[model samples]
Target: MYRTARKVAVMGAAGAIGSNVVQDLLSCGVASRIAMYDPYEPGLKGAAEEILHCAYPDADVSWTTDAAEALTDASYVISSGGAPRKEGMTREDLLLGNCEIARQLGRDIRAHAPNAEFVIIVFNPADITGLVTLVHSGLSPSCVTTLAALDSTRLRAALAQHFDLLPDAVTGCATFGGHGEKMAVFKDGIEVAGVPLAEILAGRAVNGRTMSPDEWNAIKDRVRNGGAAIIKLRGRSSFQSPAHQSVAMLKARIECSAYPWPCGAYFADGPYAHVMMAAPVTFSTLGMTAAVPDGDDEDVAALQDSYRHLCSLRDEVIRAGLLPPVADWTSLNPNL
Candidate 1:
């Protein structure tokens, strides 16, 4: 039984990221049969038959209206379906709609694909949908993951350009916190081949842009607002970055190799899992098995700040009745 021949399902496969992900998986020989699941039975942009001819012609491809049917015998699920952030829209704007979509899909997965791993690739308010899916699916948080690595990777790109360093040289740096209005990227302890990030900042200048605390803060804020900036400029949310980040996440979940990533994850210490929105986590086959939040002093402080901001958002979501009651590791589960 070749693994690439195994079944994989993609909800909203015709949409932006989903379509490309299915293709990427096929290109990598990850799944044998690909099922494209979309809620809209009619008016779909791409037909499964046609999509296969275009993207994965040699493999078996199926399209269906039923999400459960797609999940059956599936080895992986890359759920890229959700309302994208549009111009003039806020995170809270698409919450209710995406919440319902995620909740329903969670229930379906729980019933049809219990124990199957999932990757949620929706935009801002992913944690909200994550909470809904957690409750509905009752899946261990380990089996369900969200796409926060994109922000972290973005931060890395910004720093790489700022310091005139190669993108691969950014071995350090992680973006943490909610992928909302309050995301945090930690660069304090950043080192390139053992050189401190601050040292690099002091010695290098890029396009006349020097790295200073003020400049760093400004750049970070711009990175946080990068999505909004794109939306405003493009009039609609762009798909390239989302699709790019999503594929990387799929690699993390399936390949489970040691990839250092700055992404959102449920940090399990003793017996409870709290969201670690900002931290360098060594991702492997188990979907974020450990969280190494320990970093340089400034990095650690930034991490603390990131955790605080996440807690604040969690509190607000709970208070607003958007999320169920959440407890830290001690109050929740203690068997990790």
Candidate 2:
């Protein structure tokens, strides 16, 4: 458990994911105070009242439209503020609008809560939005991350189902690169009770069956498109899973867990150098320490390709003036 009391600020506290995140935080007793921010007054008020009524009755809960006020003195600032992806829209389609939202919030957070750890949950291009937040907030890259753990959760669940094992038994499953389709899963690094998952998958009778290459590809595709599949069925992107995953991430960061976990948009340098992309990161009181890739050649190449794709998208956003100037990003500290 965290030794010190924590004040958390949720930037889009009225939105679908934001509301769920607030509820989870209250349920988990993770925050001593929570400041909710949203542009919609009615929704914000309703969410605050409902959350207060249900849990953490004695906790200090407040709502605001002013970003700086909400972020003031916060230990952790989580931004789920952005446009949701509709049925026909890709996550990339939300880039410009969401990036703008992140930029404004980033500036406000920097001004008000410069020491707060930041987590970006804005959609479409989470990696780009995270980078924008890091640069605009003028915070060290280590102080910021995005929710790539959601993807890892989905992948782990998928693999667990395939192997007829509980999700908890499928250890070391990680998703790297962008939070989108280009992201790669490190199957080689995955294990089942300390045994390599690849070895088990290759065995003819392991778990009563073996997963062929084609079957593995199908699982990968499902994990990659899991968000879109949910959107197609429900007419909106996911909220519950994202909220749960975000809360878990906050817990890990607060407790300074040293185990490597998949972080959606942590800073990367070696191998895929100088980018904020999804990768395995060990969190401690000092902040993020990215794990170097030691997977097979194909997996490493895929990870690199994913990094390049994010770099291209980052360049595009910068050129469109949706993100901070390139000079600002290049001048910042490295992902230490």
Candidate 3:
């Protein structure tokens, strides 16, 4: 039966972060109908069962091994379906594996939840996975978003430490390339309390180390590698903040505020790069509307860099049979 009840679906809800996201969504009272989808699972007892057993035994919930069935009637879908970083392998290898997973989810969305809002959380290859989703889901590019903000959040935390201020008080921008070592974290136009970050960091000490652009670069590297660090310690991608972010993203979508947190979005040759960094956008009851301002040259450059990198990853994914090739994204990259 096609139900009228509003719903939210989390792919890989049986995994670490997806479980937390599902938990937070219920705890935060953000979704009345929550669905967990993991088609390869044995049965209803999935990754989330343990959490549900102790906490949300009576909450409205459903677990399915069918992605299409899980997504049906959902207003929003957030997926954390991918392998967490572990033993030695290049990022392209990660994207290849995750792209296949993302492609499967994208195909399910096309068949089951054509109009659903898209918010994917399968890290690292976020920008690339977003591209795969956009291509296969047959949804508007604007409807898709990825977990790029996780990186931005880490950048903000590092800056907060450098400036001797609360993380919330420090705002930073990251230029695009890849989600790895090559990424550019821009301090050129970053602000703290409405002032340049350079000024704010002039007085602080980070573990007996003085702050400098070089130090900031190191910090950004740490931010990019933060997830890998955790995986090393936990043998999985780990959890917590990602789950928190999933809820935050879901609320923004549910409220239609779209208020523009940095994320992954698809690009089709415009003033922006090929694959867009999720900008601060406003979401209304209708859909995604408006791009949040980066408000400067440096921020724009960072995003452009990411776009180029995304295109590279896009080619990599396409070659791996996870996505169709772009004839020539050059026609689509007006900014490049």
Candidate 4:
């Protein structure tokens, strides 16, 4: 794949997720300069040194404890902040602390890299935190996004396995709404072997087996609970998949890839108004455009539920004093 030269910054570079993101950025050879920031000097130095050993091509990498130094002149900012989710902990459990972290980090980005074109929030409770960042960073809704693609990728993987096909063969699969358990996984949007999943569910056999509605429903359940399952098996929240997807998002944004990823983007006036949630979005030089999936009535209802949940979370942030009221949003970021 071809890549362009740009100044990229990674927040929390010393953490597990951030280190993996740094490694992927280097290996992809996209940015001309990769700047890493973390308060922990020793871990940051170690992570940078580790990447030095790999000697990936076409990029210069540096580490810093100072946020401004790392972010100044950055073209893109990929940030993973807050603590990782452990077993039995829902994303809501990590909300308040992560909100504060996101608020301060967002202010830092505003103070330092106000001109940066895009930002990706990859921490726990990203839908909420991404909004916090967007508000405080004073960036337009289109300029900042979050890692909703992970849930869609999980959908892709689940469909691939159920159909006995390679992951790449599971095309057009997407989820919309929150990236958490309430996300809407649209079976109608999925395709395997170039055939719509709804067709397969309607007695069109694939791999010599027609899927029953029960099986399709089970797959949807799996997609919704994918993150929790990962923690139960891996003993930590995901890292490798998140790293790959976030970098792929970077590649898509910079290259303007035609494929629209399911991402956590702000919806201002549509059904998901004033909420940052997942939808099918393609990035380009002009900014981002979202096309919410026209799912079935049930799926649409699910999306609405997800939206209400996210709105509640946003209100919680407001009540906690992490942000101003919705009426004041335009004052902080006029583009919103």
Number of the top candidate by lDDT?
Answer: 4
Give the residue spans of candidate 4 off by over 4 A: 85-93
lDDT of 4: 0.84
Rank list by TM-score: 4, 2, 1, 3
Please, what are the lDDT tens digits per residue for candidate 3 over residues 129-225?
A: 7777767777776677776566677788776776577776665554344566546565656776567766645754443445776777688778878
lDDT for each residue of candidate 2 in 121-190, tens digit (9 for 90 to 100):
5554778887777777777666788877777778888888887878888788878888777887778878
What is every candidate's alpha-carbon RMSD to the true fold? 3.7, 2.5, 4.7, 1.9
Specify the poorest-scoring 10-residue window by lDDT in model 4: 84-93
Better of 2 and 4 by TM-score: 4
Candidate 3, poorest ten consecutive residues by summed lDDT:
327-336
Per-residue alpha-carbon lDDT of candidate 1 for residues 1-336, written as tens digits (9 for 90 to 100): 224566678888877667776676666555658788887765234656556677554688887878889988776677777766566876566766677677777778878887676555354466556655655665666666666676766777777777677888766767665675566566766766556767756766444445777777877887888777877998766566776566666666566655567555566553224553534556556565546666567656665666676666556656665455765323323322
Worst lDDT run of 10 residues, candidate 1, spans 327-336
Q: Scored by CA lDDT, what does every candidate get?
A: 0.65, 0.76, 0.67, 0.84
Q: Estimate each model's TM-score.
A: 0.82, 0.91, 0.82, 0.95
